[model samples]
Target: MPDVLSTWIAQLAAQLGVDPTHVDRTLLLDVARDAAHGVARPAAPLTTFLVGYAAGLRGGGVDAVSSAAAVAQRLAAEQPPKTDDGPSAG
Candidate 1:
């Protein structure tokens, strides 16, 4: 990871009153990517938000985050591609 990313995570964690060590950036990034591609671009942030909420309910530990992320990723993987309704009006 770049120093800027490390610095940013540390700063964000501090502001959120979370432990940086338990953040697992790589896993979270993977989950975000899965959500964006498998679901929709907008679903990425929503999925991650839900994962974090679930983890917080589970005590906000590393294991909790990992488990929630895994579930979200699995759901993303199983999601079918979105169907097109039709051409949009300008």
Candidate 2:
């Protein structure tokens, strides 16, 4: 993976009080990519932030991360595609 990403994962893991090994990089990246592509590029970081926040609210752990990721994936799938006259264009 890119050095920046690895650094981010390490930092995030440290902040969350978990080992980097416990972080599911693929799952998190997949969710972020889905949010960026399905929703909007600008939504990527916000979506991941919200997912993490939700996970924390649900009691931080593997299960919480999975639950939050699932919710984000579902929302991404349900998002409408962008259009020339879409709200995103305005």
Give all TM-scores, in the order shown. 0.85, 0.78
- Candidate 2 Cα deviation (angstroms), residue 7: 4.1
Best by TM-score: 1
Please give, for residues 1-90, the per-residue lDDT of candidate 1 as tens digits. 669989999999999998898888899889999988887788889998999999999888988999999999999898876656422232
- Checking candidate 2 for backbone clashes, the offending pairs are none
Clash count, predicted structure 1: 0
TM-score of candidate 2 versus the correct structure, residues matched by position: 0.78
Model 2, CA-based lDDT: 0.84
* Candidate 2 Cα deviation (angstroms), residue 33: 0.6
Q: Ten consecutive residues with minimal summed lDDT in candidate 1?
A: 81-90
